[model samples]
Target: MTREYKRNGNVNLFACFQPLAGWRHMELTLSRTKIDFAKQMKNLVDIYFRSADVILWIVDNLNIHNPAAMG
Candidate 1:
C-alpha cells in the first residue's frame, strides 16, 4: 500500500509491502524535506521493524539517505 500526507507544511509519501506467504516485509517513505524523512523512518523502524533481519530499502538520491535511517 502507498499513502501520502501533508501536515504542518511537510509532505510525506510512504509505501508498505508485505509478502504473500512469508514473514518478509518492506517499507519506503519519502518526504519533501530531510527532517521529516528522518523522523518518519525512525518511527517506522522502531515500531514496525525492530526485529527484522534483512531490510531492503529503495530510496531516491536524496541527501537525507543515511545508514542510520534504517534499523
Candidate 2:
C-alpha cells in the first residue's frame, strides 16, 4: 500500500480598524513575521492614513507585534 499527502499553505490576516471613520483594512500574508508586521504598519501610515493628523494603533500582544519590529 502507498500513501501520499499534500500540504496547502496557510495565511495570516493582519487588519486595522478606525472606529471614528468606520474604516477598516486587511492584509493577508503566507507567514506571520516581525517584518510582515512592520510592513503592515508602514502601509497603514504611508497609504491608508497619510492624510490623518493622528494615527493610533491597538494591537494584540503577539511577539511579532513588538515595537522593535517597526525598526
Best by lDDT: 2
Question: Per-residue lDDT of 1-71 in model 1, one digit per residue for the tens?
Answer: 98988676544465455565454444444445566666666755787778978666677777667765433
Off by over 4 Å in 1: 1-10, 19-31, 67-71
User: Against the unseen true structure, what C-alpha lDDT does each candidate score?
Assistant: 0.61, 0.88
Error of 2 at 58 (Å): 0.4
In lDDT terms, how accurate is model 1?
0.61
Candidate 2 lDDT trough over 10 residues, lowest sum: 18-27
TM-score of each: 0.47, 0.79
Q: Could you tell me the TM-score of candidate 1?
A: 0.47
Q: Write the per-residue lDDT of candidate 2 for residues 9-46, one digit (tens) a residue.
A: 78999988988789888879999999999999988889
Q: Clash number for model 1?
A: 0
